[model samples]
Target: MFTPHGPSLRELAVQALSSVERGYDLLAPKFDHTPFRTPDSILQAVERALSALGPFDHGLDLCCGTGAGMGVLRAVCRESVIGVDISAGMLTVGRDQEPRPAEPGPRVAWVRGDALALPFGPVFDLVVSFGAFGHFLPREFPELFGQVHSALRPGGRFAFPLPAPAPPSSPWYWALLGFDTAMRVRNAVWHPPFVMYYRAFRLGDVRRELERAGFDVELYALPEFGSRRDGSPRCRMVVATRRDDSSQRREASHSSLAAS
Candidate 1:
């Protein structure tokens, strides 16, 4: 659901018909007002979790649309922060609209770059991304994680909160399934595909891929969200630390992205 100030139905329709980058560029202005933006509660929880790990320096917010995840980096990191995204329009909005903390904080900057082809060297100590994974297909996980790993200093972390899958009987599950189906149909009929699928990124595949990418992966339960029927966390932050002295070897430069 979108707010009154969020993109109108017609505007959303036009965006959906465009490429992902162009669509986000069109939606950038009102992104923060939409439900699509990471919620304050989720951000706050991530901030709290990362705070316990504390005093990180030179953090990076990967795919930092409208800079929603930048606040979390600001809370825990001691030095400067950078927000990297593919959409120039999104980066513009992120650089302008994303506010500094009322208290003193690190210098924040935004960079426009592809996730599969990060421009930075191994310099960041921490990296966080919120709600951007859907844009990447499952096969892109290696390149995506590899890029994040390459951008981080040894022992550096790549973190993001992943929500548990909706129950099979829940309407939420059916809704997401339908949405993915519709996206598939739309992409088949349209050019310059708008790629977004709620059900494509699987947790098991993600964890394994992170491991294959030389990350020592760990899952931290976010207590803010309650447990499911099986007593599992409703949300868990996947904290993957790049192995010290490990070099990034996997390359997806020529990998084809399959539509899910």
Candidate 2:
């Protein structure tokens, strides 16, 4: 699935054997040439959805490898856009690549930091991530979601696109199941294993966790992808809003105690 300019088999093998951060660093140069980068169609659909929801002041692209999501942010945000990723190499490549010509849109910056331990305060009005969830395990979901929530200002949004799984009886389903099974086996027998779990990302579980983290969550279908046999959405955009009242209540409680 890689282009002619993409990483070779041996290069991919070495990356697969390294830690996630190091692997991504090694893959950064050719990441956009590979099938692994978030598809352009998804990015365009996200831009369209966010345009309807926004006019945001500042936007953050979480785990923004090669800065593809930054393009989407620039389309809707007004003042500024920031991209945060753990891989310094990825950030370097992103920086070297020429961004789209500046216009009446948010300016862009790239930051090197872990998504789980983001270094920003509640300064962003919108946040977006794409194709990075597979790197995180199920248990990490809460902490990751918490970080995203913490990074956003009150009423700020965190959005991502999620595709529905192939039907259980379909060949694609079996292929993915087989790949996940292989990954499990590899991790079981390996050291400092890479964690990429496909089945661990369930939409229902994700929505519940987002709610638990004090986000008001909603889902919107991307009609360009079409629907399933059951007539359910084929792909959905998850938009979670950070709680304004939670912060307000905390401030009020602190003030009350201080007065007492």
Candidate 3:
């Protein structure tokens, strides 16, 4: 569902065949006009939810293509905000299009970096990523989560919105399933695979991986998107806070002393 100004079918076909980085680079200029960009409504909903949890000092947006999540960070964080992405082209567009907040806000900066090996220390108080998970394979979850944990200070949060999976009865479910299956087939035959799968990121598995990566995971329902047939939230924000390393070390010491 792209607009008149969005990438054409030919452009999208070329992107799908190229490597993920190259594909995004090719699409970056028109990405906002495509359905691939994070929707404004979703962004506003996330901004509202995160504003309550914040007053943060430094913030980072993981995989911040075109910097859509920068607004959310600026709203919640106090001092400075950075958007990290792998594609230089995307960063260029983001820098060119970045909007200044009406009132004074955090200083905004863009960095070209990979999400798996983020080029940062334990400095950020808040990190938010919007609709970029599909680029990462499920097997990379541990490294990805660990990278985010390492980027955050103790008690810092890594937040992202996850929509509820469509039910089997819904046409949307079938559509997503078909898309993922096709992507798998394409990757199997193609070189420099364009990895974009809609159904691979499951909530249960993600929570477990986050906990293993030293985060206390919590889910906040976004009621603005309403509920499902089972009264479950249609969309939710995953807020994973980095656990205090000192507390963990203390517990480990106690366990070792008990064993002795």
On lDDT, the candidate that comes out on top is: 3
| Clashing residue pairs for model 1 | none
Per-residue lDDT for 26-104 in model 2, tens only?
A: 9999899998889999999989999999889999999999888888988898899999999998999988984667555
Clashes of 2: 0
lDDT of 1: 0.90
Report the poorest 10 consecutive residues by lDDT, candidate 1.
251-260
lDDT (tens digit, per residue) of candidate 3 on 75-162? 8889999999999889999999988668888899999999999999999999999998988899999999999999999999999999
Better of 2 and 3 by lDDT: 3
For each candidate, the alpha-carbon lDDT, in order, equals 0.90, 0.90, 0.94
Task: Give candidate 1 regions above 4 Å deviation.
Answer: 100-103, 246-260
Model 1, position 173: C-alpha lDDT score:
99
User: Pick by TM-score: which candidate is best?
Assistant: 3
> How big is the positional error of residue 142 in model 1, measured in Å on the Cα after superposition?
0.6
**All candidates: TM-score:** 0.92, 0.92, 0.97
